[model samples]
Target: MYFDIAYYFRVLRHVWSLKQWPGKRGMLFRLLLVVPLVSAFHALCFLLDYVFFPRLWRQTVERPVFIIGHARSGTTLAHRLLAADGNQFSYFLYWELFFPSLLQKKLIRALGRLDALLGSPCLTRLQRWDDKTFGPTRHIHHMSLWNAEEDQFVMRAAFVTQQWALDVPMMDKIDLFHLDQMSDKKRRRWLHHYRECVKRQLLLNGGERTHLSKNPLMCGWVAALQETFPDARFVVMLRNPNECIPSTLRLLELSWKGRGWQPEQYRESLRVMTEISFESIRHPREVLAGHDQAVFVDYRKLVAEPRDTVHEVYAALGLTVSPSFDAYLRAQQDRERNHQSRFTYNIDDYAVSVDDIEGELSELFDEYQWPRLSRRSDLVKSVGP
Candidate 1:
């Protein structure tokens, strides 16, 4: 319900000033028409929720677990693993994030049930659309509307999401990453909206279940989140910067290209994102150093021995894995063994260099014992699950 009207107009003005391109018309349409219409509908639905679901006001977000890391650091795998314990955790499936209001979600669920009675034609079509829509980048990042996804999309309705950069290439203009540095008024407003979103989700899923969230951008939000949710628990995933940085840049590059943005249009934003990536690698550890409720996960170990790694995480978080969840973990072990990523990126494709990464993150490289490359050719390695 709290829209960032100022930021929305700023992006609109910037987009209006850009020269013509293939995606320009679509961007204009989304910014001028689609966003306002959808936001208005969501805002109305949000208001109606109180009338229809008054118990939503009493919902609480207690001891929510957040998974934070740099992109391509296995946060998804970890989130899905924990979310498998369905009775213990409640999360926002990709489609659910778009419909934040409890009323909207319930209505959709009802419609889904009705559709099922009618041979599930609507559900079947949605599945085909999901496959086609997410097919291109599935290798880079597996995504489906039904999968538990990043909760940051909950802020999309408020026009306060980092995902806008995927279509607009305005990372330099919009800074959703650094919540701690924001003015008190703006930061509190953003986090307050986010908390309300979480509360609605908790209400929809069942108030007794723990809320689970995974977002790479949350790396910059550790301090703000701690301040907001004093009882929050965190899982910080760490991977070699050499791998995550390039992989992240490559993803943005491909996304921007597909959206009709030329390299010249997004180069500066990409550079800005590179700087953020370094901080993403360093910030969470720095913030959560002595925090008792926080746990660090090594990417290599997470892929190599997921079950043991998750068990360690559960122990650290004071959670007991149920027998069924433990069996699910054991089953995932075999799947992990056969997993492979067809996605690969070269560090040299971007402006960053090996020396730059090593120099900027010498301490992380030393601490994590991540291997350094002797030749540029070694930089073109496959990114893993």
Candidate 2:
């Protein structure tokens, strides 16, 4: 979440690389306003990090657990369950990603104190706003102010994530599938920036807790991550590609709307992300194929039986599931069950064909034994949102 001066400059440089503005004048105007405000905030954050948290910049990360998967594949709930083990795990919160500076942290603490003193609903309002804006498909992916979120935000800040395309439409041209192909010096620099962001979170959590990170976008960076944290454990979530692809398209459509973009503007981005998503699975498979450090969880099993799935995950990772953590997992299951209507996904809504999608993902389905829903009705019956 910490966007330093380097990060801002990287974004600007990427935008400049395009050499052309988006066709729409209004969109261009809005981008003009957004660029400066966001860059100013990031510059201020860089000043805060440099001036106040030198110790955090030096903190070392060790053996963190990563939750990886394609978009909407249950990584969020999985991360949430793992983070429930308060004694063993700590993660970056959604709000922390936005206000990552030491100064912002103090400001957040002051706001919390003020809320408590005045019996205000500031936190509640923020959660509601997040649910409405980011969690359009709340059942599929619910983002909140306090929930443990994907580290992609941090990666974006370091200019190492494909998510930058969402903000700067020109970035859709970047080939995110080949991050491992980056020059060693450039890759190392990006890794250092990424690690510093994680280190800040570790230092915030008192430097003793094991970091637990979830980022579907990181699936493609598996090789690099392995090189950086040799002992870190990985959990890969697998979902039926026939369902995952269209669901991802829907999410991208919503995101594009935020930028005042039309459907065509996002078609290229969608295709690239989908192609990258398939290639991403190959990374962990190649890196941790026979290694005990990696665990693969089926998405259907996770949603159908979260508690049992979580227990198996903990066992696979060689971590004990504390009674408190188990209780929290079960409670989360009940809550999700009651909110089932929130998770609705329909393949028919997207432009992709069932047969085409299945063919594209044939290797994945064959490898994972994921059922291929060939017909529209079958897809509708298989999943809700």
Question: Against the true structure, whose TM-score is highest?
Answer: 1
- Per-residue lDDT, model 2, residue 218, is 78
lDDT accuracy of residue 91 in candidate 1: 94
Give one digit per residue, the lDDT tens place, for model 2 in 204-249.
7787888899987777678788888888899998887776667777
Tens digits of per-residue lDDT for model 1, 1-385: 9999988988888788777766677788999999999999999999998889888878888999999999999999899999999999999999999898889899999999999999999999999999999987787778999999999899999999876778889999888899878888987898898999998998888789999999999999999999889999999999998898899899899889888788999999999999999999889989999999999999988888999999999999999999999999999998886788999888888999888998999998999999988786697989975
TM-score for model 1?
0.98
Worst 10 residues of 2 by lDDT: 1-10
Query: What are the models' TM-scores?
Result: 0.98, 0.83
Report lDDT (Cα) of residue 125, candidate 2.
Answer: 81
Flag regions of model 2 displaced more than 4 Å.
1-58, 121-137, 159-164, 167-171, 257-259, 333-352, 381-385
